[model samples]
Target: MSVIQILIINAVLVSIAMVVLWLVSLRLKDASIVDIFWGLGFVLIAWMTMAVATQDLRSILLVAMTTIWGVRLAAYLAWRNHGKGEDSRYAAMRDHRGGSFWWVSLVTVFGLQGAVMWLISLPIQVGSCETVPMSLPNYAGLIVWAIGFLFESVGDFQLARFKSKAENNGKVMDRGLWRYTRHPNYFGNSLIWWGIFWVSASSSTLWLAISPILMTFLLLKVSGVALLEKSLANRSGEYRDYICRTSAFFPWPPARRHGSKLV
Candidate 1:
């Protein structure tokens, strides 16, 4: 099969999966399930590519990387969302759409997410399909991916643990990775996709750089930082102070936030 054909097939498969999950979400009355499926969608594409593409080191590497990242994220999200009901974003949409939400979610939520998943998996598509030895860029991509993995996994773990504590309630999380950046997991997620892009970087597939750039944008503006902060900003004044002192997206040495004195 040609690369284009394989990519087309991957998109079709994910689209079908999303449609099916959308139906399931309708039955469960919980749109948040789609978040758990997001990771699995990429896993499906990687495995589907592995099936069609020739077995080689490049293919194996891509599959391994996607599999580890995808499955870990899927499991974590599934666990975290247990008994949480629908996510606020979807709940608000449901409230807005009311009786029309079922079909609306199928197109706006499921179909849209499926397309984005396929778009972001461009690195896997290019790398797994191409036959090449591991190069410097590939090695660097692997190292960068490892760093991202640590940052994402540790950040999520720290946040979860902090939330599990009772005393920390109503307090801003300024410990561990949160102390550095407001969204370490989101930063790490952006880095992971960029690392994947670099892994597959070649004269032919350089155009696929859009994949990582899109992921970075989504993390920063769409679902990761801007979306989360809308509610968090309403917390205590300490959170506002944290926002003032800490970097918004990137990790750096935190500076003290000053208040106007005797104005």
Candidate 2:
């Protein structure tokens, strides 16, 4: 099949899976489970694309990076939400809306996430669809993707540990990786897709250009970074204080502005 055909097929199939899973979530009353599924679902799409590969190293590398990220994120989210009740975000929305919540979840939550997933998968879509052979740029892209993968993995580990620690329980995480950025995980995630896009850019397709830019936009402006941070901001007073000294997205040293109001 042609590259565009492959992407559209993947998007449709993934969207259908999300819809089915979401309906199941309504029955089970859990949306956090969807988050895990979403991550693992990307892995499925990436490998499906890889299976159709034509001896391209870029395709192989992209598949590997995406699989690594997807598996890690799925495992972490699944473990974290293991015994916890339904995600409070969804629970609050459901309670506030009452009976129409099923419809609300369909369009606003599950459908929205599925769209974001498709947008983020642009790199993989582009890589799978490209007709050109890999080159130096592709190798560089793989390096960049590896960096993002490591950063995200380590940042998640650090934050998870901070949260689990006795003294830091229910406190804002402001040490180690978290000290450098308010949302290291988001930063890493943004980098990963951009790297993938760069690899895919070897194709010279204008439509495919939307992939990295869209990923960056979402990480910075929409559901990935903004929504996650906003929720945390409301949940933790210390988060505001952490935000004051640390960078918002990029990993950078603190400004060292002492005696300033954290809020």
List clash counts for every candidate, in order.
0, 0
Instruction: Please tell me which predicted candidate would have the highest TM-score against the true structure.
Output: 1
Tens digits of per-residue lDDT for model 2, 1-263: 67777777888878888889988998898866778887788898888777765537667777887888899989988888889889888899989989998888888888888887877787787677677777777778777777888778889899888778798767777888788888788888877876777777674654666777777787789767788878888988777767777999989898675466432
lDDT (CA) per prediction: 0.87, 0.79
| Residue 254, candidate 2: C-alpha displacement in angstroms | 0.7
- The TM-score that candidate 1 achieves is 0.96
Model 1, residue 183: distance off in Å is 0.7
| Clash pairs (backbone) in predicted model 2 | none
Q: Give stretches of model 2 more than 4 Å off.
A: 53-55, 231-237, 258-263
Global CA lDDT computed for model 1 = 0.87
Candidate 1 lDDT tens digits, 187-212: 88888888888887776778988998
